[model samples]
Target: MSKIRITKEFSFEMAHALRNYDGPCRNIHGHSYKLFVTIIGEPKQDDADPKNGMLMDFGALKKLVNTEIVDKYDHSVVVYKNDERLPEMQKLFENIIIEAKQPTCENLVSDFASTINTRLPDNLSVFSIKLYETATSYAEWYASDNPTE
Candidate 1:
């Protein structure tokens, strides 16, 4: 069977701040984020299978991404885990994500890719991810650009 690529789009609200940057983004800010995930795989070949002719069910993908990314990050404030302000921020905000890396769009997209890659069914693989921090700006990650060893 020929390989096929399927994509799904998701949106969420999130806030973040760069710890030591010398720009407006250094302060806490938020964006209505848009995320697109693409998966590549061969459709199920068994005609008797309910999922036959499908690479993967859209609902399954939605549940996976929602559980791993969307549901957790939506309406949440994300900051570097080691940010000095973390202690104070935790006290003030109930929904905070202490990420290991800076919560920039670039890093977030890469993190999303890693998450999907690890959790996807064995027959499917993440092909790419594009994350939009603004209507006019976005970052993308492609599996082809970072082949696993």
Candidate 2:
């Protein structure tokens, strides 16, 4: 059987601030985040299998991404763990994510890859992830780019 790539797109609302940055993005702002998750694997070829000829069920992929990323990050505010306002922000916001790295789109893609990779089944691998922070702006992470890690 030939390898196939399956992609699922997810969207969520999230706010984040870039700590110690001089740009306007330093202030807390929100984006209708768009996440594209691609999985690479060979389709199940066994005739007896219910999922025969399918690399993975789209519904299963939806559930996996929703549970792991969308459900948690939706309507949440993310900040660097070392941000001085973290303590105060935590008190004011019900959903806060204090990440070790600044919540830039680039970093977020890497973070998401780590998360999805660990949770994916052994036979399926994350081929790439594209996070769109805006209608025209986005960041992409490809497994082929970081062969050493």
Candidate 3:
């Protein structure tokens, strides 16, 4: 059977800053972020299976993304654990999301992909991720496009 691809899109608001940026991005700011995740799998072969028609239920995908990413990042300040401002930011805000590295769009999309990939069910595989930091700006990551590995 041919592989079927399904994509789920999620939107959330988050604040982040560059660790040592020389310009305005050094200060914390928020973006209405958009995230798209693509998953691929082969459709069920047995016509008797109730789920035979779908790659994965949209509701199931939503629940997974909500628990893994949205609930963790929404309306939070995203800072690297080692960031100098983490303590100050935590003191000022009740919700903070920590990452291992600076929170740039490129880095974020990659992290998003990794997080989702790790939690996905064994039958599904992550194919790509497209994350938008702004209306006109976005970053994309594809599992198959990594040539460095």
Over the stretch 74-126, how does candidate 2's per-residue lDDT look in tens digits? 99999999899888898889999989998999999998988898888899989
Pairs of colliding residues, candidate 2: none
C-alpha TM-score for every candidate:
0.97, 0.97, 0.93
Tell me, what's the RMSD of every candidate? 0.9, 0.9, 1.6
With candidate 2 superimposed using the best TM-score fit, by how many Å does residue 46's alpha carbon deviate from the native?
Answer: 0.9
Candidate 3 C-alpha lDDT tens digits along 4-88: 9999899999999888889998999999999998998987677898877788888888999899889999999888778887888
Per-residue lDDT of 1-149 in model 1, one digit per residue for the tens?
79999999999999998988789998889999999999999999998999999999999999999999999999999999878998999998899999999999999999999999999999999999999999999999999998971
What C-alpha lDDT does candidate 2 achieve relative to the native structure?
0.93
> Which portions of model 1 miss their true places by more than 4 Å?
none
Better of 2 and 3 by lDDT: 2
On TM-score, the stronger of 1 and 3 is 1
* CA lDDT, candidate 1, residue 112: 95
Candidate with the larger lDDT of 1 and 3: 1
Best by lDDT: 1
After TM-score superposition, the amount by which residue 108's alpha carbon in candidate 2 deviates from its true location, in angstroms, is: 0.7
